[model samples]
Target: MSHGPTPSDVAAVYLQQGPYAQGHDPHGHGHAEARGHGAGGPAPKRVIVGYGFWIFLLSDIVMFSGFFAAYAVLAHATAGGPTGRELFDLKRVGIETACLLASSFTCGLGYVAALQRKQLQTQFWMFVTGLLGLVFVILEVLEFYEMIVKGAGPGRSAFLSAFFALVGCHGLHVTIGGLWLATMMAQIWVKGFKPQIMRRLLCFNLFWHALDIIWVALFTIVYLLGAGA
Candidate 1:
C-alpha cells in the first residue's frame, strides 16, 4: 500500500542532488523525465530522431515480412511460366549484393566522417555510397528488363508477380534512398555538419543499412535458394 516517494518528492530530491547520478532511474522512466525536469532541457535531438526512425524501421521490416510470406506462398505458382531457378541469374545477383554491401560500408564511413566533422571526407564517402547504390539499382533494373524480355514479367504469372512485387519494392526503396543521399550531400555542402544535418545523415545511414540488411535476406531467400532449386 506504500506509494513510496511522490513525483514532487522525487523532483525535490533530484533538484537537491542536481539530477540523478549516472545509471540511476528512480521512477523507472529511464531518467527521461528526470533529465527533462532537472535542467536537461528535453531529450537530445539525435536520441529522439533515432528512436522515431527505429520505429519506422520496424514498421518497414513488418511490411517486408508480409512480402516475404507472399513470395514464399506463391513462389511455386508459376502456372507453366519459368521458375526462379530458370529465371534468376545468380552471378548478377551476386554482383548486386556486393555493391549494396559495399555501399553499406561506405555509408558507415560517411557517418564516421559526419561525427568527426570532416567535410571533404564525409562528402567523398557518401558520394561513393551513392554511386554503389546507383549501380545496385541499375543492375536490378537490368535484371528486371531481362526477366520481362524473357516473357517472365510480373503479368506473366502469379510467381512472377509476387517476385516483382517483393523485389521491386526493395529496389524502389533503394532508389528513394539514392535520392535521399543526394539531398543529404547537398545539405552537407550548403549547411556543413550542423546538428540538424548530422541528424539527417544518421537517419540516412540507418535507412541505407536497413536496406542492405533486407537485400541480404532477399539474396539468400529469393536468389540463393531459388538458384539452388
Candidate 2:
C-alpha cells in the first residue's frame, strides 16, 4: 500500500514553500543565503564603514609607495647640493617622532573613552592628540624652513626634490590629521557619542594610527638611514 508523506518529504515541501524559499537557489545545491546573497540584510554600519576606509587607506599607501621609490632612486643625486646627512637633524626628527608616537597613544585613549561613552574623557584625549599633531607639523615646518634658508630646498637638486616630496607629503597628511582631530573633538562635544560620530571617530583613530606607522617607517628609512649616509 502507498505510505503517507514521510518526515523528509514534509521537510522538503516546507523548504520550498517557507521563508527559506525566498533565498533558495533552484540550480545550486545550497541556499543563496549561505553564499551571503538574496534576502540577507546589509552589513552593519561599522563593518561597512571600516571596510570602505581600509580601501581608501590602501590606495593612499600605494601613492606613498611611489613617493618612496622616487626618493630611493634620487637619494644620491644631490648635484653638489647638501645630502641628507648634511641637512637632516636627528635631534629635531627625534622630537617630531616622539610627538607623533605620543599622539597615537592619546588617539587610542580617546577611542576607548568614546567606546565607554565618557564624553569629557574622549574630548580631553582627542585634544591632546591634536596638540601633539600640531606640534609635529610645526616642527616639520621649521625643518623645512631651515633647509630652504640654507639653499637646500626642493629646487636645489634631485635629492632635495625627492626629500621634499616624500617628507612633505607625510607632513601634509599629518596636518590634515590634526585638522580632522580638532573636528572630531568638536563633534564629540556637541553630539555626545552618537553612533555616526563614533564611526567617524573610529575612522579618525585608524587614520591617526596609520600616520604614526608611516612616520616610523619615514623616521627609520629617511631620517635614520639618510643621516648615517
Candidate 3:
C-alpha cells in the first residue's frame, strides 16, 4: 500500500510554495521591504517630500481661486470710477509677463543642474532666475504705484478693490517665491547638494513653476481682458 507523504516531504512542499517562497520573511516582513520598504514602512524621502509640497501647492491654488472668483464678480463694479480699460497698461504688463516666464525657464535649468550635481551651473541658473523674478516684482510694484498716483487705488471703487486683492495676492506670492529661491541658492552653496537640500530645490522648482502658471492666468484675465474692457 502507498503510504501518505512524510512530514519531511510536507515541510519541503511548504518551503517551496508558501509565502516565504515569494520572498516573505518569516518574521512578518514582505517583499516590499526588499524593494525599498515601500509597503509596510515609510515611503522614500523624496516621495514624501514631493507629496507634501504638492498638497501645499493645491491649498495655495484654492486660495487663489477664491480671489479670482471675487475679482470676476466685482470686475464691472467700477461705481463710475476709473475702469480697467482706463487704468491698465498692457505694455508694462507684457514686459512683466516676459520676465516671469523667462525666470521659470531659468529655474527649470537650475533644477536640471541640481539633479546633475553641478554646483556652479545650478547656482548660475538660479541666480538668473532670481534676477528675472526681481525684475518682475519691481515692475508690478511700479504698476501699483502708478495706479495709486492716478487715483485708481483699491479704495477708489469695488472694481479697483477686487483688482488689487487678486493681483496683489499673486505679487505677494512672487515676492515670497523670490525669497525662497534666495534661500535655496544659499543652502546649495553651503550644503552642496545633500539629499535634503536637493529635495528643497525640487520644492522650489515646483513653487516657481506654479507661480508662472498663475501669472499666465492673471495676465490673460486681468491685464489683457481688463485693457480690452
Query: Which predicted model would earn the best lDDT?
Result: 1
Off by over 4 Å in 2: 1-42
Candidate order by decreasing lDDT: 1, 3, 2
Worst lDDT run of 10 residues, candidate 2, spans 29-38
For model 3, residues 89-143, the per-residue Cα lDDT tens digits are 8888989999999999999999999999999999999999999999999999999
- Better candidate number, 1 or 2, judged by TM-score: 2
What is each predicted model's overall lDDT from 0 to 1?
A: 0.90, 0.87, 0.88
Predicted candidate 2 versus true structure: per-residue lDDT over 88-143, tens digit per residue: 89999999999999999999998999999998898889889889989999999999
Query: Candidate 3, which segments miss by more than 4 Å at Cα?
Result: 1-23, 27-42
Cα miss at 6, model 3 (Å)? 13
- Name the TM-score of candidate 1: 0.84
Instruction: Residues 156-192, candidate 1: write the lDDT tens digits.
Output: 9988898999999999999999999999999999999
Task: List the candidates' TM-scores in order.
Answer: 0.84, 0.85, 0.85
